[model samples]
Target: MSPTRSHDGLDIGVSFEFFPPKTEKMEETLWASIKRLAPLSPRFVSVTYGAGGSTRERTHNTVARMLRETPLKPAAHLTCVDASREEVDDVISDYWMIGVRHIVALRGDPANGVGQRYQPHPEGYASTPELIEGIRKIGDFEVSVSAYPEKHPESPDVVADIELLKRKVDAGATRAITQFFFDNDVFERYVERVRKAGIDIPIVPGLVPVVNFSQTAQFARRAGASVPAWIVKRFEGLEDDVETRKLVAAAVAAEQAFDLVDRGFRDFHFYTMNRADLVFAICHLLGLRAKPEEVAKATAAA
Candidate 1:
């Protein structure tokens, strides 16, 4: 189904994802994007944790700052990587102490990087299900877990992937955010399978605007998400033209979002990559507008 030009009265909920910045300039950029998108009143903004707990401290600081300084609710990402059970539990306790109510729990990537074999820390929670259970024991957190519509790279098959997600839900995951995919049909089929497996929690579609086609394609490969041939053709020969690329990216994401809305999907999670232009534009296209009160509040916070 093609996206229609009009979305006159659709009601859609949105959330955004950001990674902890590694540099001073990136930090400024992250907050700028936050201030720019805060007026839209996303359901919640999430900060990503790096593999092997590499960004644990940065993620904590970012999430804590967001909670203390902004009106936006932040969901912190927690991963079972190099940390032991005691350390992971301590981090969970810290989040609870700081008034954080939501966490995205996962068994993160191997310490080396993606595409490598995942070796769990002998002393840490081995899998996401274990991590979810640990979080529940530590606090009453509304937990979110990763869902791979395309099947996780390490999974033996799609069924196994669904089974893993079920384990997470059984352990107390309240929601699931999918890995980003270019084809909406892939997501639809995955959701159907998830339902058939008796996993009924909200499976929020993760939408990524292709701000840089090449970079996104690389990420898609690593994350086990497919970059459709049609999408590749759309960005063909535009490598040297950044302005056109941004326009194309916005159009592509808006179309995908509108198509999903037409398919009766209402909630969306955008992997913002710490940039607001594309996501903000796509949200605008989805019939979302900045409330006056929210705008004033965001401006004051800025």
Candidate 2:
């Protein structure tokens, strides 16, 4: 049997993504989500960086706090958008100094917003590949890069996107977490193409638990991903019906994941959007479980 096929024939590894919160309430909520999901023993959790270093301080603080507070390994996102080489390196060094060994390096989208043209800082790393090389030069940080299974919007073709990923791997990226897609076939084909091109880094499929139709649609637009019409129809008319939406969201996401697992995908990275309920539910469906005592603690707190 393939390594991905388990005794129960279900692929098992999972990870999560989180963004630094902007307020006290948001911070509390974020920690709650973290505490709830931590019991699942994710491979590692990532903290996202803001545009143009807007949340640089917040990202740093959140990551540092996570390092000090939890057993969960934290991966900090670093981008070559507005910071100079010296500035970016200083940030990387700070992460290393603080014992954060994993980094998600990217040539971030334009700070103005997606669809706006992206221009690297005149004195900074020019692309994700360059950023990966810089990260490797600075330290032995295990780096992750962004992959768009459907093709990045900036790239004229999927081939271009795959070539860029090849360069990222060649430049020392340890893994590539894809931009989320609704269809599992997209990921399977993308992985096949990556392997065919001789790139061997793990390409983890990014899973976004659909929490809200409007919000997910907006995010998908910003991230250069397509939301299929079928997905839209599935969530239709549940706008105010929160409970039903949650149920449907969980089912949709779980089914997508199950298909991937059946196809031999072993690792998944969830973009939780700092919401616990749906992600937790999907993880449960995938056979994730917290220790009894841990569940009791969370339940008592709840």
lDDT (CA) for every model shown? 0.90, 0.87
Error of 1 at 58 (Å): 0.7
* Model 2 ranges off by over 4 Å: 1-11, 52-54, 292-302
TM-score of each prediction = 0.96, 0.93
lDDT of candidate 2 over 140-183, digit per residue (tens): 99999999998888899989999999899889989999999998
The list of candidate 1 runs beyond 4 A from truth reads: 1-7, 52-54
The positional error of residue 69 in candidate 1, measured at the CA in angstroms, is: 1.0
Error of 1 at 169 (Å): 0.6
N/CA/C clash count, model 2: 0
lDDT of 1 by residue, 1-302 (tens): 01112347555788999999999999999999999998888889899998645489899999999988888889999988888999999999999999999999989888887778888889989999999989989899999999999999999999999999999999999999999988999999999999999999999999999888999999889888898899999999999999999999999999998899888898899999999999999998887888778788888877
Each candidate structure's count of clashing pairs: 0, 0
